[model samples]
Target chain A: MPYQAVPCRVLSLTGGKRDNDLILPINSSLSVTLHQDQLKTTTTAAASRDFTEDRLWLNGEEADMGHPRLQACLREVQRLAHKRRGGSAEDAGPLSLSYKIHVATENNFPTAAGLASSAAGYACLVSALARLYGRDSLALQVAPETHWPELRVLVMVVSGEKKPVGSTAGMQTSVDTSPLLKHRAEVVVPERLELMMRHIRERDFEGFGQLTMRDSNQFHATCLDTFPPIFYLNDTSRHIIALAHRFNAHHGRTKVAYTFDAGPNAVIFTLADTVAEFVEVVKRSFPPATNGDPFLRGLPVGSASLPEELLAAVVMEPVPGAIRYILHTQPGPGPQLLDDPSQHLLGADGLPRCSA
Target chain B: MPYQAVPCRVLSLTGGKRDNDLILPINSSLSVTLHQDQLKTTTTAAASRDFTEDRLWLNGEEADMGHPRLQACLREVQRLAHKRRGGSAEDAGPLSLSYKIHVATENNFPTAAGLASSAAGYACLVSALARLYGRDSLALQVAPETHWPELRVLVMVVSGEKKPVGSTAGMQTSVDTSPLLKHRAEVVVPERLELMMRHIRERDFEGFGQLTMRDSNQFHATCLDTFPPIFYLNDTSRHIIALAHRFNAHHGRTKVAYTFDAGPNAVIFTLADTVAEFVEVVKRSFPPATNGDPFLRGLPVGSASLPEELLAAVVMEPVPGAIRYILHTQPGPGPQLLDDPSQHLLGADGLPRCSA
Candidate 1:
């Protein structure tokens, strides 16, 4: 049998208003690429037909039109489309928006592994919907400006939590709050740091780990020594640091350094040469609370891909889940549209097939 | 007034007894070629004339022989010579051994800065003595080994207040004890360690210090994990390590690590990328414990010479003054005879002239 394909598009959104009426600007956007795959045996035949229909899968299950957030997002997006097309606000006649979205979302790595799978899922869903409605490219290009309120709605939906808790806004605010932020430009010797990074990329873990740990520590320490004393590193983080130091001292220099976010879970950055060594050391030293718990399993390394438009605005924190799985990434260009839209997840009538 | 040239023949005595049992087997001889300028400036006119006549310098204030270890060492050498030649156990006789030693010493840097001035001085002394004696070839051959004992003696003497508390024996024992010592024959690693040593020799301090600290840490750590536990690092050493780790964490990766021996003094090693940063951090973080105290002064860098004949036999530890300063050395040939006996520290009469 010939494999069925779907037509899908992705969009990025940014910026929003808080409940307190303070406008929180979204500095980063989320992207997702949609593709079609054979139906799994676990999925019911009706669910598979639904997938062939609306092309939407919710929470890895069949999509339901009744999901509150989905309903709210779709309504808001249609309202914005109506407004942009100079239509009357009171018209409830479907708003005449066209195109369809097929969504199949999977958290790239293990769930509950301290990776931000939730954020990615929501971001991808909203992005897919926006693309289906033909607003994705335009929305991303003008981002936070051309459609500020719509961007806010998208961000809120993607974040999925009730209170719009900062998201990328917090990162910007932190950078803005830093007195040393200005000095960061001066402290950097690009050539030297580049050489070091190259050396790191070369898998000289002894050398690379030494540098990475030092740099991260310095960066965090500077944050602490800042006027108000911001601490990204908590007790657990410090314990990890201490453990790593002891490990390096015990063994010859190995590649393992701790990077922390606003929360406690640690993101250990290590080089290929010593990654195994690091995993073993961490496994021995900081085993999970439960014997069979997979939350703190071996590190899943990968790259964090962002659109070219968003790259300059992005500032990676010691954020563990602010990032998803660590992408063992190298430099590469942004998304290139595929020639065949059939490779995406949509139906012949250019409408999403109901998966559920 | 003509600058009168003084002839001195340097001779090295090898047979030594520890607790009345022969510990050192004397097989080779050494000679030194000394000019008048090379004589100690503090030597009285009579002592100078005596040095010219006897071709030997007895222990005296001018020679800094007030140091009991230096005195004991010379006496031990003399005693062994008499015993070896006379073949009589009781005779402290008028044993005749002809050799002249020209001595010149200076302290260009601060004496208490923990520089291995003693090692340099002893090495120079040995070199000069070998030249004065007709046994230059043998002295050159065993120069590295010969310096080890004298260097040990100098450490003991200068450090004073001791019964050879920290002896070179512990350090040199590795030569006999290390199982990997024989593997040097089959190794093809381009002697990365040697390249590191060469980097040290070129006074590439940043490179040297980094390697030195790492090697020293490894060396001492190995010692601690040796069959019987040995503690080369003390509390101060731990403090230094903690601080370096902390500092490195704050900055980007700096090539600096700290290593210590039995003493409290620390040797900090850093590379070019991090040398300046390390120095600044050290200066800011570690002010002198006392106003005028010389120890714990900022890092003072030095190099090792490639000893001519026995590079393979000698392993230089990076912890400066760990066993006192290592001779900046490369491998060279063994000792040889000098053409001019007049330039020898020992005159033709073969008697002590100058007080050593």
Candidate 2:
């Protein structure tokens, strides 16, 4: 059996739509492939196996292989592979429909921490499976990661703890109870997506940044509008949002943008030109917990001295250690295969590696 | 000239609508007069006064005499007084339109603390001036205070500091930026107000409490949807909201309801029967900063033991000093004239009393 692994999947700037009705009418998002932070998935398929069942491991823990979504993905892949064979044994050699598959996955960062771990995980899984089965899986690519080279993403990990309410359940409840969710999904999102695409195409940082923040806010607003209401953003998240707004308002332009997923973490978007200054501002507003190690990862941001007026403008009661740390990254390619055998998450024995 | 003082005014369960277009279509609210939390104002009209202009003092400090709203109220009162004289000099006695007015007002509670100070103060001013000028000011009242004797209000002073953004400007921004605000004001408010009124009329605490909380959350949701967004509820405010929801969900009934204005403070409503238990839950969730000098004021609430499961349901990190204090009050009379001269806020010189 041949094994394959894909690294560095994408995380979207916009939230995913789960409502089937809303998804059919209009479902769009602006996404950027992350370079530094990644989720790696390894897949191995055997036409003749000792074990007759498919198996999966996540972060060294064996998870439910019969998970409905996983089953659906596996069924779809096998169906495509069977069709490609066309009843002839010639095309089915090692990639036959009767093969059992073993999969192992792990993330370099925190899982279920609102860092889009599921998105990256699922994308990597499907991509790796497609490669193993010699099947082509079509996925939408609005613009390549290289389209905007100067764009940067800062993942502010406010809390890496698992969110109390999972996105699936939270969004389902929102669809059932929130009156404004329908309006937002049907009316606001489509128009905003068009504008976002335009801003990305034109590289209009200010327009892109403002729209990003507004859409994120409207999403949370709908959550708040839900019955028994949901509060995803905590004090630290709110403070980060306020700081972003103040920093932009002081400069009289949109210098920074912030988007929050289902949890308290914040993902900030800014251009390469303004990243240094904004980092300085963030550092001042949310002082790091310790001075021993670097509080930032990925692309290094040089220190920039902000003007007195600018510093004064964004000044608030600093909430020390509000942000645990930041992962500084930029747009890069989606799901690249690792050519090195040592990089595989699964060992040669068809099980997750001990260090995975 | 005779002086009169109205002791108590009212606070509504719903937020006030300032959008002229929305207000014209549907502007209804259910209010209850608070007995213990009162804003007292004393007014005297001198037919032959030495001073030519109207004078005013609020909380013993001289305020802007030419404030637009105050001026408009004064002009309307004088116009009514002049018309009532029948255009005959003999009909116009000491209570004449040419009289110069002197007004003094004070509140026992903290000013600008989201305690409905402005509402009470303005209502007191209008009621007092109308009596002095022999004019009648018709106000729409759905029900008097005695209508619901069991209904109680608990003012949770999350932070007594003045709100950063006043409700006036905040509503204007919402009208301009938030798409949901228009829908809420026009469609949601009227229907919700009807339901609230029916609940009040039928003494349905469950319905009334649920609608009150929903309306308040939607109001804040609109604020969140605004561009650059408005955050009226801080960490402590959000905690209180969550606690209320958890408590209600635990019992599978709406035992307590919370409503927040344009500030962090929470105004909670519960029936007399549930007030003691809910108060116990609140005390456990938010323990007092100091056990001395009773953390609760207004109507005394007898202690009740909450069940262990109920306590477990509302268990959260106690934010010490998050709430400064609580005011337990009940609905009472709107406004009454105090015949006692000693109760007047003004001295014999027609100025604010030194101790006022």
Candidate number with greatest lDDT = 2
Q: What lDDT tens digits, residue by residue, belong to model 2 across residues B1-356?
A: 33433333222223334644323212455565566443233443333356577887777788887977678777866766777777676545455566677777777776665565666666677777777766666766667778888888888888434576766566667777887776666677777767777887888888888777877787788888888788888878888998998988998999889888777888888888888898877777778888475688888889898778878878677767778778888776656676777767776777766654
lDDT of 2 at B61: 83
What is candidate 1's local distance difference test score? 0.34
Candidate 2 residue-wise lDDT, A204-314, digit = tens: 888888887888888888888887788888878878888988888898888788888778888888888888898888888889988575688777888899999988889
Per-model fnat list: 0.00, 0.59
Q: Would you list the C-alpha lDDT of every candidate in the order shown?
A: 0.34, 0.71
For each candidate, the DockQ is 0.01, 0.65
Model 1's CAPRI class is incorrect
Residue A83's lDDT within candidate 2 is 74
- Clashes within 3 Å, all models in order: 89, 0
Q: What range of 10 consecutive residues in model 2 chain B has the weakest lDDT sum?
A: B4-13
TM-score for chain B considered on its own, for each of the candidates: 0.42, 0.88
Candidate 2 has an lDDT of 0.71
What residue pairs clash in candidate 2, if any at all?
none
